[model samples]
Target: MPRSRGTNGTDMNTELGIVVAGVSTIYGRAVVRWAAAEAHARHAELRLVTAQPAAAVPDRYLPNDVATAHRAAAVRLLADLAGEMATGWPGVIVTTDLATGPPAAVLRAAAEEADLLVVGADDASPFTEAISGSVPGDLLTTSPCPLAVVPRREWTASTALPASAPVVVALDESTISHAALAYGYAAAARTGRPLTVVRCVTAGSFDQAAATAQARLLIAFGELYPDVAVSTEVEPGDPRHVLVAASRRAALLVLGSRGRGRLASSLFGSVSRDLIRRSGCPVVIARTQPAPVALCS
Candidate 1:
C-alpha cells in the first residue's frame, strides 16, 4: 500500500491495501458492507471469502457428489455477495474466494496478505456460531493482520460512522496495548476523528501513578497526530465495563489480543474477548505483529 500524509502531517496508508471479509449468513453481509466502506476509505480492494468445512470422513471415503455440492454452493454464495457489494459499494474492487477448511483456518490463511480481516460478531450469523462460538476469539491470536469484528446493526452505505463519533482505544500494561494505541491514533488521524485513550484500573481503586505512566506512552503519537483531538481517561472499574461503556459513544473500539496478569499466558485475553462481544461498535483486535514505533516501559 502507498503511504501518504494526513491533514495535519500524520502518516497514513493511502492506497492498494486489501481488506478480507468473511461472508455467510444475511447478517454477515453487514460485515462485508462495513469492510467495504473501510476499503473504500483506504482506496483498497475488498476480498470476500466463504469457507466450506471439509467432510468429517476422509476424502476417498466421502461421496464425490457431496463435495461437489459444497463447492458449488460456496461458489454461488460468493458470487451473489460479490455482486451485492459491487452495487452497494461502487469504485472499490471486489473479489471472492471459496475455501475448503474450518472457518478459522480459512480466514487466518486469507488474512496472510490482507491489511484487515473482518468477521461478524459471534452468534450474529450461522458462520460465526460455527467458528467455535467466537470468530474473533478464534482469529485473535492467529490472524496475521488486524481483525475487525462488526456487530450486526443497521448502517448506511457511506462510512456509517457519524462525522463526530470518536475512535476509542483501551490500554493496559501489556506490550501489545501499544499496537492498539498506534492503530487507534492512525484511525483517528486518517478519518479526522477525535480519539479517546482510556486506561481502566481495577474496580474500587485508582492508581494515579500507574495511569500517569501509561498516559505518557501517548506523547509521541500525539505529537505525530497533532490534528487528532485526543483525550485521556483513567477510569476505575472492570476493564470490560469501562470500555463497553465508552464504546456506546464510540464509532470504533480498538484493543490488543493479549494483555498482562493471569491472562498473560493465554492465547487471547478475557477482556478483549468480552468487549468484542459486547461493544456497541466494531471491535478491532490490533495486529499481534506491529511496525516499529516509540515504545515506553
Candidate 2:
C-alpha cells in the first residue's frame, strides 16, 4: 500500500467510512440526502448519529422520565431514517446510533473512525438561534475527519444549476486551505465540474492569490487530477462576503478551518461561520486530519 504524509509530516493510511448527523431539522435531512449519495459513490458505510439529552437531576429525585422518553423518540426517528436510506441506496450500508450530550460533541465522538463527517448548517437567524444554533459550526473544530455541511439550497437544487457547476474553494497560505483545495479537486473530479480556486484579499484584487505558494500547491494537486478543469480567483473584499457571493452558482463550496481545537467554544472562525450560514450551496469544511496529504495524490 502506498503511504501519504499527513499535516504533522507523518505517513498514514485511510479507508472509506462516513458519519452523518441527523435530527429533526431541515439541515439534518439535507445532510442525510447528500451524504447517502456520497457514501454510495465512495463505497462507504453511512452511520447516522443523533444526540439525545438525558433527563436532568435535582440532586435527589428520580431521573427525569421525560428526558428518557425524548431520547427514545429520537432513537426511533433515526432508526426509521436509516432503514429508509438502506432501502433507497442498497449500495451504501447504513447504520444508526444515539449519543448523549450536545449535537456537536456527539457527532464528533462518532466520527472518530470515520473518513468524513456530514452535518446540516442553517443561515443563522434569531428564530433559529436557539433551535439549530451552532451545532454545525461547533463541529468545525471538534471533528476528527473532514466535515461536509449541507444546506437546504443544494439538497433541494434551489439554485437553478446542474452539478456541472464549478466546485469553488477558499484558498490561503495555510495547510488547512491546501487540504480544502485537494478536496475541491476530488469533488470536481467526482462531479465532472470545473474547479475554481479563490482567495479573498484585503487589498488590490485577488492578484496575489494566484501568486502565492498555496496556488503552486494547488497546481501540484492538479497533476493528480489531470482532467479537472481548474481556474483561480482573487477578489478584493472581505473574505466572508466574497466567498458567499461566489458560492451562489457553485455546485459545491469547500473551505478549510484554522482551528484544531476540540472545544465547541471555538469550533467556527468568522469566515467559516459566515459561509456555513449564508452560502448558496452545500459547503465542505476540510481540516488537516485524516490526512490531506493525498490531495497532491
lDDT of 2 by residue, 51-138 (tens): 6544466323655675556667877778677777777777566667776666566667777777778766662322123224634345
Segments in model 1 whose C-alpha atoms lie over 4 Å from true places:
1-15, 57-69, 124-126, 130-137, 173-176, 203-213, 258-268, 289-297
Per-candidate TM equals 0.81, 0.77
Number of the top-ranking candidate, with TM-score as the measure: 1
The CA lDDT at 213 in model 2 is 53
* lDDT at position 278, candidate 2: 84
lDDT of each candidate versus the true structure: 0.72, 0.65
Kindly report which residue stretches of model 2 are placed more than 4 angstroms away from their true locations once superposed: 1-15, 25-27, 58-68, 123-137, 152-154, 157-161, 173-176, 204-210, 262-268, 289-297
